[model samples]
Target: MTDATRVSPFLGLPGAVEGEGPNAGAPAHYGALVAEQRPLERGGAVVDLGNLGVIRLRGADRLTWLDSLTSGLVRSLAPGESGETLLLDVQGRIEHAAAVLDDGESTWLVTEGTRADEFASWLDRMRFLLDVRVERADEIVAAVGVFGDRELGAAAPNGVPLVWHDEWASTRVGGVSYATTDAHPGRDWDLHVHLLERPALEALAERVRVGDVSAAGIDALEALRIAAWRPRLARDVDSRAIPHELDWTRSAVHLEKGCYRGQETVAKVHNLGRPPRRLVHLDLDGSLGALPAAGAVLHVAGDPDRAVVGQITSIGVHHENGPIALALVKRRLDPEAVLAADLDGEGITAAQTAIVSPEAGHAADVPRLPRLGRRSG
Candidate 1:
């Protein structure tokens, strides 16, 4: 959220949608931000995602070392390539999420700002004998967001803007997914972050002033993300998180990667075990019920005293759809179950639209080898 000290470079631009709370200091709309962003063709919309933490990993062993710890094929990334990775705890619970892009010389990671310091400390402790030099790089380079197919209109680290293309918009290579929606809500949601500096910000500001690129705030950016069911660690993920619960295996968790901190639980959950909860999108009936805030408890239509079945993790106001939300609910809750969010003292109706299905364990489908070379008659 932007405030007195942390203002966006694009602040005070014409038609900016100023925001509050998580989007504090950021624009929610640019007068035309909502309408022009769908089909969202390419290269016009930009936002100051200064809130994200940028980290740089340099050294000969950087790639290999990162690959060893995170759920990504980092060692295989070529210059200018993009990948998403996750760090997990011993129990396979998600610890951190990074949108990564490599420029050969350095690996750039864009992550939640609040956890950057702690994440860096963890990396430092783990680099006992490695050649890796891990540290926060925001002071050297700022975080910027671009939502189109245009050239990154900023200074380049190596002929490019050190951008980390978002892969969560769709299923990526070497990953499994549970979303089966015929048409993904975010199919046109293409947003990436650029790591640059003050001069770059000036260059971007110049471009925006001439109508070269349109500007949107975190609110506009988030509404599209919610429409697509995209997950954000700061908003959707909490202390009790596991990759499977949010269907993150589709992009962040590489099931076939070498051993990492939480490999055992990741493998087990997708094979013999089931995620304790499932991710679901809710098209909230916004008529009578006010928008539920994060941590809002949910229940089956009229069952309040029956124990909370789930909680709202993220909420947004879609440009077209009145209000929408993503919630983590008990896995056994009927996909067709009528649900409601407790808003203030009222029960607002919601229709459950499943994202991760119960039958999502891709491990069960992993082809097995011949059993003892035995023949079947």
Candidate 2:
């Protein structure tokens, strides 16, 4: 569990609003949330991710051991390189996701603070005779998120800046994209995570306070994330979530990598079947003057009495796109269908845009063979 008593220095900045729930221990927004978003999207500001959990791994077997367990190709990751990986269950359901950065001597995994302890505990159980040693480094290091290619003077612990660049903007090597669209919104998404020590974090906070640097809150960052159709483990994942449903294979899963815990399921689903659900981007009706609450049931727009087809996972009012949301709907749902979210007794209409297409999966495209039958010639 995350330390509830831990307070971030970013919270002391002018117009800062303390976050709650999953965003606890961080600032939700500054006084001007919408205003703050524009700067962040343009790479003019940074978001404090100090609340995120950091885990450090040491020893010679660290990289190779991690490669055999997760869903990414990480054994060859060079020092200062960034990688995204997922820990999946035996059934191929997502268990954890991390932004990975290695510094030659030590490997760092930055993940949701709420799941840190459980993630670390599981890693410990799997370390039978490996040379690796896992330790929770939350108290020793923190993370900050930068929106673009701009540098923020990140700390270099082993002569390499401890930064993890997100690979969302393009298809990763050995990864396949599930989105059928020619232009992907994620192509414009540029995010970087910088790890820093306590003194550096405090110094960076001071820079924001004196107007020497700019800062945005998690709210702004979230809005942009939703607009980009990015799926976060904490928000978009459920008990049954597989990487395919969220199109995570584009970044986190290497299709040709050697077997891992869930390799069979991942291979079968990609070659012979489709994900049960598909992720979609929604343009919500803002005329009602409210955003649909997370987990609100969704139905076909004109028929509120119809069976629920999906639920809202993440919702935000984007600066450019008024009200937007990311949802996981039944795989068979029509891509052009108009949807509605049940807010109380009222239905707020929404236009659906496919992120993970209904046609996703079955990548191998094997052809059917003719069946032999007994006959007299």
Candidate 3:
């Protein structure tokens, strides 16, 4: 049973409205969703990500062990360096995602709150003869998200500020992008996560209350994230999701890394086949005054049969972009084809912007041999 009484201090702000689902235990908005979103985009406001989980790993084998288990190449991370990594099932389906930061002596993994316990337990079970110790630090640490490189008075337990800078703006070494667009939306994304001690979080909350620092909620943050085409493990992924479909290879995956749980599938898919589906950004028609909920079925516009071609994964009302969403559609769907999302009995038109290109995958460009049977004219 989940504890209903657990809540973040930021929820005490005036006009705060609690969030739901993955954002539970934190404020959804402070009465003005759009207004709150503007300040956040400009790096003037902070969003309380207290719902994120923190895990600490300390040992001489921590980095090497983690590199062997996750998708990112973290074995070479220097002190205070940040990286994004994904834990995949044996079949290459994403299981967990984390913002990784090292403080020389300890490696901190900040992941979705809902996955913390399960992630920690799995790590504990895998620690057979390693020098590593895994500790769930949710009770003592909290997370705050901000844009740009603004200083937030973060806690520095090991002489380095506990901040995990997101590298989604471009592909890193050993990484490849499935998004064919030269000007990817994520090029403008500059998100950062700060891990804070209990005392630091309390102090920051007081600053927010006194107007010394601005505060936004998950609603505001979600809007910016959707607009940037950033994929969150908790919201954008389904049971069959793999890194290739979401173009997560742009940041969260290292194709040239050493063997890991799902490396075989990752390599095979990239070298020989295309992802079954591709992610796209949807500019939803908002004249109906209602946004399509996540998981809403999407169909080709003007289709007489209304055959479903995709499903919405995340939606947000951006301050500038109005209604926008991310959805996964069939990779073979015509890129110029129009799409519509079904909300109850109404259909809302959506303009598609490719995130993962339909032509993605087949990275090795393997040649196809001529058909052996010869032609029948």
Candidate 4:
């Protein structure tokens, strides 16, 4: 991949080839990690989530202030509770994704490491009269994630103090979903992350070394994420992305939340029943022996010479699904349309069997729009 480098707490591990993508610059995976994915899915794997950033927020008005600023209902979050939130631009384009957790004394915001500084800067600028404190704890805290079903303490190792459990694997409580499958595959994903302090970081890595804990790399984690049709900010978003397109309404959004940045577009699109594009999961032909990477072009295979219509957002080699990818396709493209993904210069056939249906917004049918620039008091 790219020669760019990042620090890894588990740098001493074997087969750690600093990865690319969400866990970019971190160990991709250990040998044959994919073969052990089922055990991971069942709850016994710990991963060095160095690619994720940890931020600590503290202040009397922290919860309420954040509730007024984001798409999550964090104002009333109790101790040890976790939820997710999004910060969108005025046009309803997703700008920041945050995994929020509370520990009574502080609120923890877990997000991509690459964007933590930017997110912290934005948070600093928004604290006019609010009693809030925002600070990046990347130096003091490290992140570890687990895959499978188990108690938070058991699933998360090293006695990590903060955790944000997976909510996107299903239509989490309070979330309204747009998925059409009879049984959503992600209903069993069971992913979660734990935050540990610097001193304890090596302790956990030692556990993996001594065989007390099993470690998977970012590659293994990504396979499951892509197979579940999960979206990631580093891989899935372009500057123009809106929550509706990724079916983010299923989580990381509050349909009934009070006005915040981008509420207008969030409301308009969900009610009007339209999104410019839709998220689709593609089963790519594996005969080429090479999988398409993100940004690979998707074409309508039945059309003359295969016309370009979309581009892959995420790609992976899932243990069960084999070679698969996620793409943002033009919303109106027929569900049954034959598809192909250009892997490098080689064109590979693809089939669309899973998607966030085009008619997703049908459930929210707001008949009238408020006058321009008017908001209710």
Candidate 5:
């Protein structure tokens, strides 16, 4: 076994290690921890998503203005209703991706923690002449995520939105005001519990009794996200990559919506056809050795030694599929092309994972050229 494969005492799971904490040097279960805690195998799992963004938009125009600016149809979100949405620039590149909930009095946007300030600033600029007030609620709110099949409680004013999504059995507990959204497995729900006190935060974490998926880690979550083909801000896309390249058109882009900042480019691309690149899944061929760093080149199928076809965005060992990765490949490459990557001097062959194919049923399509630039050669 490779030295990197050495198991640590902190996480009984194999190949675990401390990832980004005060205990950075400490050993912890990297992927196994996440898997054990995923809402699937076990009944529930808790993630301290305090690092994710929580933005509060209050004022009368909150609904109409937010719906006008973002990619989701948020004007329709009744109190308690929740949905995932994306904030895009004029070029159609994603600025931030969020799961939002409305509480009649206010709207809450929960996203990656790093995007809190940036999203707030962007939304603030778009609020010209509108009655909406945009503010980052990070200091006032604690974000936690829980996933399971169990039924939850009413979490909104008049119980309107919560009652609307009654089909899902998840709820928030505590005196703190907040918003709750129903979500799919591996698709975590954001609990923007109002942080009135420190003890309340600690108690909420304990009450939920979030069991760390002893096997799942950020790595595991990345693998699952890649398998599901979810795109993240900064990593999968930037000002350079359009939303379609990352397959975010489904939940992020509203084709029927009238107009917004990047609407022109988005509509042009949709009508003309062909996004710059296409997101693909990679089933990495290897043991539990190591993974390549982000942006590592993937060799093209027809010419592996010379031409590069794509780049890896995320990598990990999946609980069900073992070593795997997600990548953004040049569109010229065949959807079924055979590819391989260099992982620590070892040649790791990777088969294209099925993502956009129609057989998959929900696979997102590559937006046409007018919507995004031509694919990189």
Candidate 6:
């Protein structure tokens, strides 16, 4: 394995397995690993999530202020709804990716893990005259991601207090005061967000019979995200990666909302043309036990020795498909481009490839409706 894909010595056990591959145990490959270890009969076990950020939006201006600050149309969200948003700079680069959850009284912003305190404080400072408040929720709540079994999926319902009873594992996820049965038996699962219950969460984290789960580290999680064709922040994008470039204009940006930073650039580029690079998935066509390193050039087959496309950002070996990878290729490059290269003396080859098809970039040049509850003279 190259330095980029090298298994870290600091990580141990289950973390090692998840961090070792590109799928990070989310794709079919990781699913197989879970089967071998736990050998599930009715349900399957997924990885536990920790790399996420949580923030609370309070005060009277919570909804209006957040609507103005983020890319999504937050002003229209109802009590039980959740919307994804992006924080973009004036130059159109994304600073953060957030999932906003409305709970009638307040709003929650869950972002990819970063300096939670710092980000919350920075957002607070931006509120100046607006009657809005921001606070870090990392200390107040601990999160666990669970994906499998649609039957148990509703454990974390949108509007009500989270509660479940699945024999071995059951729990509650929210600000409510309640206890739950252990419904999780290493099967179809749900992400648990225990509020103001740090000790209980930690204790539960220990008792859960999840083997090889701890092995899936942040690196592995990233691999699974890429394999799933999910967009990641820094790896796939740079300071110049606008929402449109990431095909995130629809999911993250609010085209019909009032002006915000980067709105002009977003409007102009979107209306006039498409971004230069696009995020794509690749099936490496070689026996490389490890996948390609980030930023490794994808030399198209016919044009050997010349790079018609860019290199990889994420990679992993699949259970059914073998070696797989994700990269930001030049949009004009052929979807049928024969990707070939060598890593650590292993000849890397890829056949299958697909682009993430998000909604077309927005045209913000169109006039938007007035924002509600603006400070009126």
The candidate scoring highest on TM-score is 2
Off by over 4 Å in 1: 1-7, 12-25, 28-43, 209-212, 304-306, 363-377
* Span of 10 residues, lowest total lDDT, candidate 3: 1-10
Pairs clashing within candidate 4:
none
lDDT of each: 0.78, 0.88, 0.89, 0.78, 0.57, 0.53
Off by over 4 Å in 6: 1-43, 115-118, 148-196, 210-224, 302-305, 345-347, 356-377
TM-score of 4: 0.90
Give the 10-residue window scoring lowest on summed lDDT in candidate 2.
1-10
lDDT of 6 by residue, 187-304 (tens): 2322233222345444434433244233223443344444445566646666667765554653466565788777787767676555666666787765445666777777776564
Per-residue CA lDDT of model 1 for 1-377, tens digit only, reads: 54344466666677766665445445666676456445343555677776677788988898889999998778889888889899999988888999888888788888887777888889888888888899888767777777755565444677755777777667878788877575766666677777767677767767888977666667667777888888888889888889888989888888887898998998898886788888889888889736888788888997747467888888877778868889999988889888887777788888878988866675666677779979978
**Candidate 3 clashes between residue pairs 3 or more apart in a chain or in different chains:** none
Candidate 4, residue 343: lDDT: 63
RMSD of 4: 4.9
> What lDDT, from 0 to 1, does candidate 6 have?
0.53
Candidate 5 worst ten-residue window by lDDT:
172-181
Q: Give each model a TM-score.
A: 0.88, 0.96, 0.96, 0.90, 0.73, 0.69
- Candidate 5 residues 274-377, lDDT tens each? 66667777888766467677678888544735488788877666677777677877766777678877766666778885443312212225454554765676
Tens digits of lDDT, candidate 4, 244-300: 888788888888878888989988888776888889988889998887778988888
**Best-fitting candidate, measured by lDDT?**
3
Instruction: Rank the candidate models, highest lDDT first.
Output: 3, 2, 4, 1, 5, 6
